[model samples]
Target: MGRRARARRQQQQQQQQRGEEDGGRAGGRRGAGWDGGYPEIVKENKLFEHYYQELGIVPDGEWDQFMGALREPLPATLRITGYKSHAKEILHCLKNKYFKELEDLEVDGQKVDVPQPLSWYPEELAWHTNLSRKILRKSPQLEKFHQFLVSETESGNISRQEAVSMIPPLLLNAHPHHKILDMCAAPGSKTTQLIEMLHADMTVPFPEGFVIANDVDNKRCYLLVHQAKRLGSPCIMVVNHDASCIPRLCIDVDGRKETLFYDRILCDVPCSGDGTMRKNIDVWKKWSTLNSLQLHGLQLRIATRGAEQLVPGGRMVYSTCSLNPIEDEAVIAALLEKSEGALELVDVSSELPGLRWMPGLSHWKVMTKDGQWFAEWGDVPHSRHTQIRPTMFPPSDPEKLRAMHLERCLRILPHHQNTGGFFVAVFVKKAAMPWNRRAPKPQGGTGEPRTCVQPSPAEPTAAPQEATGPSEPDPEPGMPDAGVSASPESAESDGARRDGVCGPPPSKKMKVFGFKEDPFVFIPEDDPLFPPIQKFYALDPSFPRMNLLTRTTEGKKRQLYMVSKELRNVLLNNSEKMKVINTGIKVWCRNNSGEEFDCAFRLAQEGIYTLYPFINSRIINVSIEDVKVLLTQENPFFRKLSSETHRQAKEMRGQTRYAAPSCCVAGGGRRPCGPSCPRTNDCTTCA
Candidate 1:
């Protein structure tokens, strides 16, 4: 047999062996790497023919190669989240242990190296496996590698999904102080990345910057919470909001109601996802030209909202998984035209080194499936069909179009990076967007409260106990995600009016967060309760005493929580501007009488890292042996602490009872409590 035929036989035979030996077993079809059943037989739809024909114009000779590459599954890729406690250590283990097992692995007689990190990714945190996941699981030598993925992902040490999905976060270049917004964050792979970057400086308990992760679908926000909880960053606030009409929020800073804005925004809008043909093999059959046509307005509106919310000089990344120019360059072109020089496509040529990419198309045409060609917007069928915007068409003046510089946008073809096709366009807000003069504020909107959607907190399931079982639901960037929203056909119809222009209605009135009174009411500085706990923990009086608040929720919020002054400003100032879903961290808690300390406020485990440096007393170190015992205890109390711990606890006695400090070993260093930490070791507890 020839090389191709022999390779096919080898692949099939190995698959058969795997099915027999481990098919229904640990790493099988119903396994961690397996994304549901085998990929469906997807074929091109006729409706998408003209769409491809138009894409062919700018791509020139590369069109055939691009289309052919999407036929196969994308290589699995994941990035270790930054600002995580065990990030570097986990990366070390992967390189040495898990990846080492794949050193001698081969599939279809093709030698496959262990998962390799992205050359452009800093610190080698992002990794890519050259082969599709199916082949990887079938290979005998790579079994342990597969098991590693299942385990590590469940433990939140790794995220497994698609390669191209990792691009937008890298482009955002989040910092420790930049307040960020994820407009359509769901199954929050990128949201988690942004959270990590927000805390990348490793500042604990709080970040000067915060991430407001929002999704249109209220149900999918649960998935987003699941993803966000893994990072353990207290700075994230998940909300449900429609991207296009997300309400404006304001903070009263210096007696001015400053509009709540983000230093960076990620608008990974909903798309038809034709570029996802690799893993979502069904896209081939489901592909339709109308998918982009219907979604163009939504994408345009979402990106525009993102721009409006962005600070001047702030950057917003507009991305889509579809390869269609209508969804990619066309929407960007629309936003630029409407921005009136306030938005510019940023050239990120040097951003991700060693990344193979093509520039965005400067020229393309719009064609209907009916073989009708629109030479220009004027030629579009206004009466026969809905009017299409000028931005949807490549401008008649080539110079003007070239000046738009859409080429700065990055396009990742599957063959170029062994990844799925993706389009990413970065725009910097050069100046405040000139609001349309025709747009009017909602009636009764002045100084009146609007409706609100209040959702109960989303409690995520505990981390996976074993790695080699059903694949955890922790989807990284890439692959089909949870339900994003309604379908495209209905989306267009719901979004359009008699003119067929799509625009979701804004809030009928200004949003009021149902605040008759401030919740973060300040406790007097000299309150009787402050001396015992304050003296014991040695808290700085300089810390904003007013930002601390007590709440009734005892589960996760505990009894006492502290919001950073910056974050508190946003929360208080924007009470009428938008719906604030969830915010703040459990910095301190009121302990029951049974706890080790009678003090009402013991430093919460999540907030300890950030608060520890500020605290002056009530800290005791124990041996590693004691640490293990504290972590493993069941009664939520560490009764076996050394003399150092007992003496420290006695200093802050108040309604005292022993309780879990949640202190557990992390990075072989004394770290904050984890979920697995029973909060038993109260030694680190600031009572």
Candidate 2:
């Protein structure tokens, strides 16, 4: 409060501004500082500028302040109706503060005992280990500062909206045994969320659910794999294919059609991504009303594909982070138009936990291609274009299909709720179509029987495959075993099995062959080259071809080219202080080190070499080009180790510690709150 102190503070602020302009930027984009550029175009766009103003934020000054305004205190209570036993665990976490007397709350006009907020005592909120997660507590607001902390914690501050979008997994009402699909999933948050939902809590082991998280981009498909493992979910399968082509009628060995219907499906499809303004400011720079107008076609295509895969009365939540009506209401409207009343939007405001929202527009007018409201409103004078005018609601008639009723669709407004805008519409297929109504006939012109059509990966099938059971072997020798060996060489050699791994070896039988006989395979406690893993094999005999690429790297310089469930687990579960030496892996290098390149550069292989920069651990797949570049690229590091030592060093660094520095940091950071001269001050190394 002294004059000298205030003057010093002001001087420091000015210097900080100069440093920012002079390139003292530190850390990767995720660090708690500027991502170091002008506020993203998306953040500065005309529309987004207004959004910031509505939130009482000054757009130009502080970007984080603009974002923090979007955060609101989440409701403390989550109602669980059917699963009382499961509800108890949720209640237990909230028992102490707001609902200590669980019995006082009445549901359906009857008194029910609800669990209360649990205590929030933990040494730390640990990650990357199999150790059980401590239940976070519900502490009361004690002081002015303490109230802020509690508010931040309860507002889901532990997660970003990108992470929050994936919470659908935690809200599962379906059985864990059901099969699920994340249609149009990429940059995969929702897919990972589903994995978390189906996966057992810390108290349970090996959850009974399964998921096939697929994406059209072969590159993005691998991301689904990484996210699945990071979230600690084993009950998931990542497929690199289009969603619309998911096969419909896969037949088992018994000649029975594969009825792979899913109890739950997530259609978190592609959109304009307007809701990501806080994180992806680039979108704002290129923001256009036209882009959203075009995405409506793809969004509908992906959603309809998801619906075709849902079991009767099964739940599929269609969602997008974009606030544009075209990506939300219009797409849902189109799907309902095509379903012939077979698919009905399910009310989700009452179904989900955390927050409530207003339903989607039941009736909406589409703007004409010429840029005027089309229906009864007709043409507008050119002079009127500059003026903002609201269109009148169209008159009802017995003729055209009524505006697809979407009272079930829900929208989240950033201004109204102080949260990123989002739209969600949950749809359920009706119990049964009228018996008198017959499906359309196939293209031939005769009095012939109709045939069952198989669904494509993009079409969304409704059947969930169970682990196959043993039966009479096929008349053809060895037709019974599938996925017995994952190596390409072995699949090629086994004439007995349809899928084979081929190598030059003349006398290689099978490595393992009891898949149908036994779904569970055990590994010894002390296995060297391979770590222990729980593999869930798909049992649908007629499903699309699923294969794995596994091999040992051979060269004068020895290396390993294998990616497995076991190795992924090891990196995800261990953390000790370690140093990161970059390996040219693209995913690990995003927004890093000044060099940027498209990951799609290599197509000859299915994977890449990943060096755990921290531990020197190496992972191999289709190509190690990126990892090689990352490791060899010049930085401040000096290479003093032997070639062999270098290989080992690179492999060790490929572990999780090298991947997620934020999660691995202790007490978060070493530097003091204010600036000090690293040249003069004693800098504590991260190690």
Candidate 3:
């Protein structure tokens, strides 16, 4: 065979072996090729093929290539956190150290493709590798690179994400002072990206804006918290709520209560994740028209709710992992119709240059599960109307279709970019929705009070357990399988309509479910804890002392967290109305052994960056060699250190921290300290 044929055969053999070794067993029956396991999942579904074929989304002569790409395993992709000072350093290390080693490496006689920088991602921070995740783990040649990825990912310096999944956040154009919301954020890859964008300028100790990440499943909210905690951002808040009915919250604006509308909203709503089939093999077996048909109403509801909660000039990016029009363009069309011109689709063709995508379809047909097709809503029989709604079909009026500008939306296919399919539609709010044209009334006005039953004092205030393994397989950003009814009554019900009204009066009691979170108790400015910490660290007087808070009310405060002044305002005003699961970054922890040092609280690595700017004293600068020794050795005596470091260590009387200049560690002088120890008075490094 020729070289190309040999490589293709080798790939097929590896795939066959993987299926035999990993496929789940069925009935424990041993057969000639079964090994007591189930047959390999056939990556073919007649219904799926027929449905898409009818949609005619694939370009001419590309149907076979599209199917082939979908069948192949997805390549691994990762993104370096661009806001960090060490981003360039990480990129350099990957290029010179790890990828260079793999230049001549081969696995099972198949040459491995060197990882390349994604052309669209700025600064060469994002990368694409042809190596499958399984090969990265099993191939001895790639072991070192795999370990590097693991370490960096855990440290929040990098993220292993799907390439298409990174597109929505980039389109958001988040800023440090923009109030943003992730309507269905979980397994928070996109949410962390937003946090990174918010802290793009590290000089600002605390950004004026915050991100509120919400999800309906209470348990999944904890997973979202765990992922967000890695970034150590105090401005991000986790809330448990049905996105379609998320309560409108109030925030203090210039000493007056105002309805809180997000400056940017990411409405990546739940959908049938047919686009993620390349990675999630189960999607092939479960793919059907019913999934999208059942989810269209909920998707529309979430998108409408997002538009309602967005500022007049704000932008909302509605995205989905499913390429099905029922879940992509159909929901966008319904939302725009409901808005009555309050929202308009934005043409982002020039946003991410070099990206491969097709314009959203202005004409498409919806199909029932039993091979029934409808070109218009009126074609559906009365009995099938409950399952298929008018919004699921394309508009019959050519003028209306042109006005919707559905073609502005983006649809990325697997073949064009060697990536999983994705859909993104950007909407910019031009005015308030038709139903919510009036300004929000002040609190305690005609609106009924929105409150939840308070948790008892005995409830434990412990943090959620840390994620043990790699991020749990989240359904492509916002793929929830629950709440999939698409009946017309449910879509047009008064409850759903009221949810679209900005700051509407509570139509019904808001039920609070899941574990009750500990109350956020703000520290009094005169609290005894502040005096010693301020004096010992020589903190600048400009710090907002009152922004410090603890989760406990009565017990000794063991950890001190600080939020931006903006987040504090949101928490104080909406605590009763919103289901806040967790917020705040731990800035200080009580050190029982440090009582003699005149300060009981020591700096926490999680919040060192935010606190570093305000600390004017007790900082000991060390050399790069000193940092290496400190990290390598448990206890290195002063004699082993350089002359200057030794002298500085001797001069310090109490517990001391060491820091190396950013330039010495990462070749970046934008910050004073290294990435691992941005600011510290002791030998312990910051994350």
TM-score of each candidate structure, all chains considered together: 0.72, 0.46, 0.83
Q: Output the number of the lDDT-best candidate.
A: 3
lDDT of 1: 0.65
Q: Per-residue lDDT for 1-687 in model 1, tens only?
A: 899999999999998987878866777665656686665475666666556665563256766676677775567788776566668887898888777777886677877767778887788888887656677678765676677666667646678657778889889988889989999998889987887787766534567888888887766877887777655566777766667767655555556434566899999999999888878877877776667777777777778778877888899999988888889988888778777888899999998889888888877767664556665687776673463556687767777677899889898877776778799999987775665212333425453222212111221212222111111121111112232233455445433422211112223331342212213333446656566666556677765666665542123334555666676666544332334444555566665642455355555555555565556545455566656665555443445666655554454342133443322222123454343243422425222
Per-residue lDDT for 283-321 in model 3, tens only?
A: 999988999988887788778778878888899999999
Residue 528 lDDT in model 2? Answer: 31
Instruction: List the candidate numbers ranked by TM-score, top first.
Output: 3, 1, 2
Segments in model 1 whose C-alpha atoms lie over 4 Å from true places? 1-39, 46-50, 57-65, 105-113, 130-157, 203-205, 369-371, 385-387, 436-536, 542-544, 550-558, 588-597, 600-604, 623-687
Instruction: Report lDDT per candidate.
Output: 0.65, 0.40, 0.77
Worst 10 residues of 2 by lDDT: 575-584
Question: What is the Å distance of residue 599 in model 2 from its true position?
Answer: 40
Q: How accurate is candidate 3 locally (lDDT)?
A: 0.77
Task: Please report the TM-score between candidate 3 and the true structure.
Answer: 0.83
